[model samples]
Target chain A: MDKVILAKDVSLSYDSNQTIIKQATFSIESGSFVFVTGASGSGKSTLLKSLYGAIKPKQGSLIVGGVELNNVSKSKLNFLRRHLGIVFQDYKLIKEWTIEKNITMPLLINGYEKEVTLNQAESLLKHVRLKHQAGKYPMELSGGEQQRVAMARALSHNPILILADEPTGNLDEYSSQLIWNLLEGANTQLKTTVIVVTHHIPSTLNVDYKHYHIEYGEISEIN
Target chain B: MKSIKNHLSLIVALISILFSIQVFIVVERSIDAYKENLAKNYSVVVVSEKRIANSEFLSIDGLINRVEELSPDNIINRLNTGMDQKNINLLKLTLPKFYKLYLTKFPTPKEITTLRKNLFSNPSISKIEDFSNNHDITYKLLVLFKGVILVFAIVVSIVTMLLILKELRIWQFKHSERMSIMGLFGAPTWLRSAVLFRLSIVDAIISSILIYLIFMYISTNRFVLQQFDNINIKVVIFDTLNDFFLLLGVSLVLSILLATMIVLGHKEEV
Candidate 1:
């Protein structure tokens, strides 16, 4: 399989004095379901941030979808980001916008026509089982529903890869299961590369997935 | 109610600033009109040994315009209590020749002095009354009035601008999260700031229209008209199309400039 994300001896840190990810190297294959699991403050989120260009790696090369993220220009980074979907733990939906509009955000950013974006949002709302809640604002939705809306937004533009950081961390078990199924569906049916950063992965997942564990600022894949 | 609360300070600031500007403009125009009216009714009286020809007075620089030869017949008539026709005619001939010289516009005190100098330079002229003291006092008062209005307008504008910028910064802080999220999703700077720009433009239009209606009503007010009539001066309080476009431009530019500052501040924070 072709690699969609490749990090070679990448080092990341918020402050120059304390390194988070120290010379860690990894690669994620395209069209694969991958989970990055680690303890709290073990640099799991930092690695994800580097992949999205939110934070540049201090050393070595990190490429996402064939674009090097180290010292990347803002415009080029935004261009690369358009092709990727990101799901935040807090949902991060625009509070002033309705669920439908929230889901259409990525499409709008990608310059999709109004009719096309509206239709896409409608379809995604149905897919997420929030068609009834489409007109409601983010604050009006429950945590579970808002997460689902964020998931729909992540999948709206049919991104090449979806990077989710603890998407189900705050959801109930039922919502968690639903979100996992959706992520699984995106990986299996849509063949999108899915990389999720979480502290725990459910053992009951009934699909093939690669697991990478981070310990002491080092990452290694486990069976 | 919430919308009003959110924008009240901004609207008030805009209105106050714009009102000051309009008052400044109208007062300036009114003063100019008053000066012109005074110029029409004011003139210099010159006494000469021989009757001065209107053409001779016109020959002096800045002294040309309307010159009238005054007849000494009025003084002679007042003195003719019981005089005969021959003595009355003799009294009129003995009176000095007086002429009034009108200028095209109000002359400054220095210019008045120059005119007096030019008049006195003629050997035939004996006395010139240019009302230097009155002209000096009036000119000084006019300058002082305009200066006060200008200073007031400038102070109000600067205060209003600072208030506007501070308010915009608050709005930026309020919307920062949403803007950051949009940025993460690859939205361009313009797209992320669309809401800010829209809010500013809408407020600008609203304020501009409000000022227009206010000035329009004041322009036709009886009291305002009475004041101008008292001075025999006609001043256009406001020109609808011209003033509207000017206010709109000012409001729009100010809002946009303040908004741009806030937007650029956000970029620096990131």
Candidate 2:
């Protein structure tokens, strides 16, 4: 299978004095479900950030979807991000916009026709079981519902890859299970490559997923 | 309520700036019109040793628009106390030639001096009376009034613009979170800040309309017309088509340019 992300000896740091990820090398294959687990300060989020072109790799080449991310131009990075879906822990939805509009954001950015974008957003809202709350703003929804809306948004564009950062960290058990099921469905049904950065992997997840643990600023695969 | 306050701040600033600009234009036009009226009524009386043609006065100074000989018949008739016609004719022949020189514009003190010197350069011109003292006071007052209005307009515009910028920056901060969220989703800069641009543009249009209405009322008001009439001067305070379009264009350009500045500055900080 072709590799969707290839990082060769990548290092990350916020400043020159301290390095977060030290010369880590990894490659994620297409259509593979992967989990990255680490301690609280083990730079798991930092690694994920490099994948999405949020932060540049300090040492080596970090390639995502066949584009080199190290020193990537802003326009080029934005173009790459348009093809990828990203989920944050806080569920960064524009509170002023309706949930339906939030879901349609990615499609609109990709320059989809208005009618097509609205129809797809409606379909995704139904898929997330939030069809009743389509017109409601993000502030009006519960935390779990907001995350679910975020998940729906991630899947709205049918992205080739989804990078989720602690998607269900603050959710209830029921919401957590629902999120896990959605991730599994996207992985198995849609055949999208999924890389999630979390502290713990849920034991009830049934899908076969590769796991990578970060320790001491180094990433190593676990059998 | 908050949105209204924001819009209000921008609209008020735009109105003040546009009002200052309009006042400056009106003051400038009024001064020009007043100067033209003064030029029409004022003239220099020149006494020449010889009979100088009107063409000679034109060659003396570019300021001389027209020249007319002052007919001596009136003075001759007034002095005649049953005098003979032969003596009256001799008196007319010996009397110096008097001509009135009309200027193209109301002359400043410096211009009057230059014209005086130029007229005296011709040996035939014996005496020239420019009435500089009265002209000097009127010209000085007009200059002072124009200068004061110009400075006031400039100061008001600058201060109002700074306030507008501050308000716009606050607006940028308020929308930064939403903008950053859209930015993460790969939306372009223009798309992300579309709300800011829209608000500013709407305020610009609103301000333009308000100024147009205000000026239209002032231009047609009986009191304003009475004041201009009392001064015996005609000034075009507002031109319905030209001034309206000019203010609208200025407001739109200013708002857009300021909003772009805030957007670019926010981007750099991020």
Candidate 3:
């Protein structure tokens, strides 16, 4: 199997005395669905940040998409992150842009022309059932609608890896089921790697994915 | 590419408008000053000879000079009811053999600054040295005023460009809805920002045209020309226009530079 992510003794800390995730090691295989769960401050978000190259490991080496985390150049980080879709807890949508334009934001950044960008944005919006909200601004949309738009933008370029941080943390039951189904679709149909960080573990666990628990600053496979 | 093109057009238009408005201000101000200087200082002086007997002094021949009689006459005066040279002899013929010196009060002090500008030394000298402090005051004020307007125009453009650039950044950031687009498509950050900044440059150009129209309307009024006769408003105006154009040129180049920076500086982290 292709190794999409590998970490060996990856320790991260904001200050000298307190280490967030200390001497922790784990590897996530390519094309696999994984759910990471822990208490409120168990460094789940930090781990996701490290994978997307947001937070650098303080000590030890780690790799994502075959790029080492230590001394990773910004340009290289950008290149690596293009393949990893990160869904923030807050949705992180630009308030000024319309929903359709937001979905194709990645494509536009990568120099795609308008017609093609629009088509891709439209296709993704259709997948998320928000084709009608293309011209509307983020602030005009509901909390769940913003997250769905964000997810469409993340998947617009067909990223090989998906990193979702509490995608349904603030959603209603209807919206939560909608987001989960979208993630499941991407994982099974496209063979895309999905890693979701959430506090609540769904009872059903609909998709076939490994469960990892973070406790006392160490990661261990639970199921 | 289309976005880049749009931005370039915008920057060009703004600089052109700003430069033209400043040029118009210079022209209007100069004309007003010239007219006033001519009106207030146009006077004739009659003088009695220094060493004449009372009888000789009284005669028109004994009087050294009368300035109004010698000034250049134009076609407007030729058409007037008063004929040239006839007005002169009529006054002379009626004069008594004894000359009575008719002098305007406080002569040199009033137009002394104008005299210096014309480089006229010994202009009907009564007493040479003493001069009013106010004679030089207008000159100082006009110079300072011109200096200030020029600097203000430049500073305003620079600051406006900065603010416009910031707005463009935020606009582009929102326009890039596909947060993954930055990474996935291998697109450089400058492209989106270039498009948005270009729009602001266009707005600057539009605002400049509006300012020019405002100046054009104000220029038609014959404003305080006589009040500022001692100073050359033209010199100040032309100097200012030159500076204004130069500054506009600099602003265009700087805005383009700033747009480029915005393009390159946009974030990659989504």
Best by TM-score: 1
lDDT of 1 by residue, A1-223 (tens): 8999999999999999999988988888999999999999999888888888888899999999999998788889889889889999888898878899999999999999999999999998888888999889998989999999999999999999999999999899887887898898889999999999998898777679999998989899999
CA shift at A19, candidate 2, in angstroms? Answer: 0.8
Per-residue lDDT of model 3, residues B109-149, tens digit only: 43544433332232332322222354345445545666777
Q: Which stretches of candidate 3 lie over 4 Å from their true place?
A: B1-188, B219-270
Model 1 chain B: ten consecutive residues of lowest lDDT: B261-270
Report the candidate with higher TM-score, 2 versus 3: 2
Full ranking by lDDT:
2, 1, 3
Predicted candidate 1 versus true structure: per-residue lDDT over B1-270, tens digit per residue: 545765666677778778888998998998899888878888998999887777778887464578988888778777779999988877777788999889888888878878888888898899988887888898899989989989998998898778877787777786677788888888888988888788788888899999999999999999999999998899888889888898889888887886687678785222
Q: Write the per-residue lDDT of candidate 2 for residues A80-106, one digit (tens) a residue.
A: 888888899899898778999999999
Q: Write the per-residue lDDT of candidate 2 for residues B1-270, one digit (tens) a residue.
A: 646776898899999999999999999988998899999999999999889988988999999999989999999999999999899999999988999999999998989999999999989889999888889999999999999998999899899989987887787777787788778777789888888899889999999999999999999999988988887899888898999999999999988987887787775222
Model 1: CA > 4 A from native = B1-9, B268-270
Ranking by DockQ: 1, 2, 3
Model 2 / residue A36 / CA error / Å = 2.3
lDDT of 3 by residue, A11-122 (tens): 9876679888888778888889999999999988888887887778999899989999878986787788667777889887766568887787777665679999999988
Ranked candidates (TM-score, high to low) = 1, 2, 3
DockQ of each: 0.66, 0.53, 0.22
Can you tell me the CAPRI class of model 1? medium
Interface RMSD for each predicted structure: 1.6, 1.6, 4.5
| C-alpha lDDT of all candidate models, in order | 0.87, 0.90, 0.65
- Give the TM-scores of the predictions, in the order they appear: 0.94, 0.91, 0.66
